[model samples]
Target chain A: MKRNVRSSLGLVVVGFALLTSGMAQAAETYKMDTEGSHAFIQFKIQHLGFSWLLGRFNTFDGEFVLDQKNIENSKVKVTIDVASVDSNHGERDKHLRGKDFFEVEKYPEATFVSTRVEKTGEKTAKITGDFTLKGVTKPVTLDAEYIGGGKDPWGGYRQGFEATTQLKLKDFGIDYNLGPASEVVDIYISVEGIRQ
Target chain B: MFINTETQYGVVSIVLHWLSFLLVAALFGVGLYMVDLTYYDPLYHELPQWHKLFGVVLAVLSLARILWRILSRSPTILAAAGWQVAAARSVHWALYLLLLLLPLTGYLISTAEGSDLSAFGWTLLPGLFELSPALADWAGSLHLWTAWGLIGLATVHALAAFKHHFVDRDSTLIRMVYIKGQ
Candidate 1:
């Protein structure tokens, strides 16, 4: 009985060593499949505090590192072209890209860099990141759900995620008062990436 | 009565003239009214389609009218001094210029998104080309100022017609208003 216990304890220590050394699982770096149009950063805000104004940033590229063995080490980085803001209406989109809103001429890009990722559920995580927009940086939390992952038709691996976050217009230095109800913008992100 | 006779406007010219006037006047009134509309108003969605459809109509008719004016002979200026004749001619050309410009600038504004614009449930025209936002703003400004200018010039044209009818007692206004039975 003592010999059996000693052998079992030795096996447990070896398993722990392999896990701590990260030799059993390797982290994968995935590039967003933006060229295939499988990613979207969609947003909606109240219009004049009366109705919804739907829009999206058309051009963006991003990548993420998924450490399955340790999700805390996972990271994400994304950059968006502010000039590609499309709100369906030409005049409104133009106005959004001008000095009144995004000021794309002055600051043409918005970026996000993840600082921490905490697993909240089997298929969900809370990703905390520094989101910079219009030259203002703030810590934002994204409630993310892993959608799916598998081999692609071309013999490549792919993973997908969906996330949601709410941002205040004033937090990004966008002080243009679009009225009381238009102050907060709800963001929904659906991202699909290819293993690279 | 279907063609010009150098003394009176024919039936076609009279019809086209009144139609153009009515369309332009309606567009001016509607466009002015739309500027004050709130987002929730049903007319906010409905009015622009009708407005743009009628704008297309005006654009087509304006081209046809200009072609007709050139192809057909014009009636003589009646009971007018040389300066009055010059003023009338200048006003006519200015009106033509505005008719063409208002539609073109409006087109520029609509097609800036590089997509097709719909009018009254029909695809009117694929954008000829996409315009930059700055250029689109310039187009909008020109559309507004030229619309105001068109309304002003049209008013002057009408006042001159009334002057010939009421003060000068000439056939100038009657010729445009009436088609000879013939």
Candidate 2:
């Protein structure tokens, strides 16, 4: 009985060592095609319980790993500059970046690092990640769909995807009280990556 | 002349008492109204600035008031029961504590996101710490609850004074308000 416990403890130590040293990955890494201006992170929400107001973050970069044989092993990491939030209207954008909304001067960046990726269908997956925004980190899930991958005209191999998610403004520490109707914002993203 | 005697409040004590109470009342009223305003309202931004401005004023005044109370003698309670004396002492201590607590917690919440707290074109407290969301949330909860606690205790304190004047027919309330020596 004691020998059995000894072997179990040995296995636990070995597992911890493997996790710290980074286990071998069987996925291909791809860099986001941000230089070509082919990526988008946009959001929309109800404006004053009457109309929809749309906005997008213009500057961000990310990378993803795709295991073709097993999609569950895929990983994604993205960093977005919160100061780049643009609603097209200059005056409103100024207010959005101020103390009322994002407070970009204080919290300059928002980031997402995937913790789990589960393949739900042949072309769809659920990506759960820890998303940090406005100095608060919360777990968020994105419903992602895989698009086609092909060789571009510039002679580079590329893969494309689209995803959607929703976030509560107050949950991210943005408690500016924009009324009950504007509580949640719908996020839409289209990412195209180049094989590296 | 500014020090309290055996049976009467000093001029300084009376002034501090009225000033702090008036400040607390104004701050609490403005705080309740400001937190509920929508983003579109002009007062949404204006009120918080004033709130923090006055919060700084209260923080300094409350500290000075506590110091003065410690350095001076308090007038003896007249026509009071044993339980009333103890309750009044406890209530006075709690009021002073909460008065200081509101601003301390407000400082933590305001500076949590790495921004210095500024009031009336001057920086009151520097953001010496980094961004701390957990501390910010904790302080925010404390600030909200303590505001109500302070107001509740102040009401009880006032009622106690009224009880002394009306029910007990004593000179307790009059001593604090009415001044002598021209």
Candidate 3:
């Protein structure tokens, strides 16, 4: 009777260990549902020193991994279709895609990859990343907020995030000059991801 | 010589009249040339600044001229037939209306496009309206049309002045050109 009890206790200990390790390794990978998800990337720049000209990129794709237990281990990656810039004018849009601005034919994509994430609050983080635009890479920090994560009605897990950052167009090699017009551009991004 | 009398206009009216004439003529030339410039043209950005600069100046001067017209007296129309006097009066009124409308429409277009008006590096008016492409296009069309109308009317006005001077042998043009009894 004493030997049997000892053996059962040892098995229970091993089972408990396995269960905890499995839980620790369960870092969820969220794939970007490009069709169902909404990803809006908008920008604003000063026009002729009078007011901000608001514009947006109509097409983009991105995904991010969420490790709730290990928050620092979370990662994000995004790719933007540069030619999709729209400022509500066809002629201006064409000029923007020309050599004076994006030169979209030669360099068609802009991308961002996060290097580190630091949690500043329960739901907010400062994500430092390398942003590549016009073939130039520069370090930028996005102030991000994790909106929420949950099981969707369709039996899929989903996560949402919104972030904002600012960059100088001149830094990205976009040196088009309209005197007194602002070179600093404000960028806003909102993304939704699906658990793959 | 600073005021207008029944027979002649003062020095102020003559100066304002000729100054506005020269400005309007120059603006028409610049306006026509700048519209044809493509995005890649070197003057594409530079030319608009100049246009806006001069446009604002013309608007302010035109407004002042209107105010001066109200505050000051005017020389009587040169002795002529009833229809001739009426035609001259109508043309003069149309010219004044065009002077105000051209700048006003241009301002609306520029501001609607979210662009400020500046003159010689000094900001005159900051754009305050949200950008509406439709409104901008409409205002631009109106500005162009009004400018052309002003050009046509001004030509007719100059011809009328010449007719009064050479054909009618009246002091209609001379009164505006020289002080009283020159």
Candidate 4:
């Protein structure tokens, strides 16, 4: 009985040590500071064959895990309120949210969750993720550049990133016929995260 | 026959006049069709862009016509009473004014609604005005009213031309229709 007890105690000690070491090596979690941080997500699409129509989403929330040691293990997830789309025109915005476009009433939220992170440079990485938009999910890759990370005046650690990707509106089930403008759309995301 | 003579229109004048008439007529048709398009129409997005494209082209062409008229001498009016001459001149001048005013109001409405004027695939003008629903609505109404005025004037002008050709049995219609030295 004493031998069994000793073996069980040894296993418990080993498990505790492994758990603590794993925790130390795990990535740092960052909560999005929606008020203090700014998340600018802009999209540009061709207007006819002439100019690019620029627009942006006004509301979004996201969080990310940064494993500075093993950057490949970092993960990011973003949730965008699809109804917050604005193109500086009320009628256009309303039209966009209708069935022919985003159909925000039916699919009110869009989300992106990173599946893989490929480090390309010292400050740049390619983040591949599954993006759910308008009830459809597709894999998208974004070129992300880590701006910097430092402690803020409020005594919180913060990190900034800028990511860009090109997507086809048709892929998201937003296949409105814009003639020559019905091509690919460029998406830009600039976000800052605060360490939780 | 490149310049206008007292007897008939020259090549340049004839070409500009016919081109403007055809384009303006087509624009009026397109404008009428596009305004009735609903948000659910498949052409809701595309038709407006095309309308704006044609509107800009018409505006540029009308300006050129005005400049040409100013720089060159036009054929003298056929012999008529003082009141007939006055009525014809007023109608012609009103048509010119509407040509300018209609496009200007359209541009204002489009720009105010936060849309640029593009020609085919080329952007000629950007949306420069601050977005205001009220301003867009006002400009749209003006554009519609001006379009109606243009249609009415054009119809009267056409009827008068036919009357001069068939009823009055004069060279008033022939002067613009037949080229000089033809």
- TM-scores of chain B alone in all candidate structures, in the order given: 0.96, 0.94, 0.92, 0.90
Model 1: residues with Cα > 4 Å off, grouped in runs: A1-42, A46-54, A57-84, A89-165, A168-183, A188-196, B180-182
Model 2: lDDT equals: 0.85
- Residue B39's lDDT within candidate 2 is 78
DockQ of predictions, in order shown: 0.17, 0.07, 0.03, 0.05
* CA lDDT scores, all candidates in order: 0.88, 0.85, 0.83, 0.82
True contacts kept of each: 0.22, 0.17, 0.00, 0.04
TM per candidate: 0.61, 0.58, 0.54, 0.50
lDDT for B2 (candidate 4): 80
Which ranges of candidate 2 are over 4 A from the true structure? A1-65, A68-196
Instruction: Summarize candidate 3's per-residue lDDT along A53-106 as a digit string, tens digits.
Output: 999987788888888887889999989888778787544665577677898777
lDDT of 2 by residue, A1-196 (tens): 9999999999999888767755423466889989988889999999889999998998999999888788999999999988778676533564577677888768989999999999999899999999999999999999999998988998888889999999999999888777889999999999999888
Task: For model 3 chain A, give the 10-residue run with minimal summed lDDT.
Answer: A21-30
Better of 3 and 4 by DockQ: 4
**For candidate 1, lDDT tens digit of each residue in B1-182?**
88888798998899999999999999989987975565457697778788889999999999999999899998887755899888998899899999999999888877888867678678887777877665776787799899999999999999999999999998899999997566
Residue-level lDDT of model 4, residues B96-180, one tens digit each, is 9999999988877656656676645778788776544445545767998999999899999988988888988987787777664
lDDT of 1 by residue, A31-143 (tens): 99999999999999998877998999989999999988788889999999988888877867766876668988789899999999999999999999999999999999999
- Indicate the residue-level lDDT of A192 in model 1: 94
| lDDT-superior candidate, 2 or 3 | 2
lDDT of 2 at B49: 82
